[model samples]
Target: MDASIGRTAREQLTGRYVLSLVAFLALVYGVTQDIETVFAITLGLAFVETISILRDTPTVDSRWVGVGLGAFITIASLAWFAWELTTAAGTGGPVWFPALTALIGVWFIFDARADFADGTDSYAPDDMDASEMMLVLNHGHLVVEELRQGPKTVPELADACDLTESRVREALDVATDDGMVYPVDGGPIDDVERYALDESKVGGVAFVRSNGKRILRRIARPFRR
Candidate 1:
């Protein structure tokens, strides 16, 4: 596999998020009984989606618009929740749930957004790590996302990703290629392998953090001149 990055952007959208939106909509409706609130929340998320698309990838150079928008929205939602909480007749009961959901949702988006921006250049020996990182992010994003929650077998990953078992296996292979994940019991991952997240990865968390610092340095370089 080519270790050089072949794509300027890493994917941020995936099936799990789609599932989340559907589930969130139902939960909000169940609690609020208000189409207006549902619309409001959905619209807010759509806005976040737009942000994820434009400013949250390796192609972007330290763009903060979408991330900042997410922060603003979460803060605003929490503020609303707080106000409602204090009122005797406050809709806080309803607002609190969505508000909390918004906080979680924003965080979820934020985490993905940051990760999508990772470029192996700043964090790892690109010649060695880039190809593997590319495979996992491009082909196994959903798989990796779920694994971050904990270890699982191919069937479990397929179910979570809404992909077929065969497809999940393929992605799992990509994940395992660069040690992104490994079987919980150790050794080569087999057909029934249960995989867990490899936290020491140079191509994931540290990748994103280093990318952030790289961007910050670039931004500050001009000012320092």
Candidate 2:
């Protein structure tokens, strides 16, 4: 499966952002055009985004409540919009808008299910290949370093890495997806989630550089703090 797709995780994430933004904007434009049912649907979508902002899944507590909320909102919005679209007559607005919305809805549903199962903070259409996995795990050196010392909470990793909590979580999720990391408590993460490293998977030139980087970071951490 390593060669399933050549795209990297970062590239996948960028594409997802662009696609979601375009879908959202099209709905807005449809509203301006007074496309029937577009207004209610847009409002529902807006509410979903607002909840996501308030919950802040990327940096939220590891209890998975925020993740569940995000998934819920996603499907709910689609359901509401779908109902509206079906019940009302089309203003014959751009045929493309509804089609795009449906496509995006399908994607959202798939991803929402995934987000609930695994705390993947980033978009992952499918399992990453070996090289893609390496690339993601490599960029998260500080997280690996902290985990090697022992298990760590998101805030602890964030502090150690001098990265925003959100970015630290993203790194953890990326590593987790590749089997390079996992929660210390096993199956379900509790209120205070602490992640541990899988040393078996940590071997390679990437970790060699990462080990050197960790050593350097340890030396400079005090001053940086």
Whose lDDT is greatest here? 1
Model 2 deviation from the true structure expressed as Cα RMSD, one decimal place: 18.5
| Model 1 bad stretches (over 4 Å) | 1-42, 56-66, 92-225
Inter-residue clash pairs, candidate 1: none
Writing each residue's lDDT as its tens digit, candidate 2 over 105-213 gives 5444454455555655333223566786675556587789878898888888888878888878778877886578988663454568789888887878666766677
Report, for every candidate in turn, its global Cα lDDT versus the true structure: 0.65, 0.62
Which tens-of-lDDT digit does each residue in 85-153 have in candidate 1? Answer: 776867636765757756654863454464445531221113435675665466587888888888897
Among all windows of 10 consecutive residues in model 2, the one with the lowest summed lDDT is 1-10
lDDT value, residue 102 of candidate 1: 69
Q: What is the lDDT, from 0 to 100, of the residue 218 in candidate 1?
A: 54
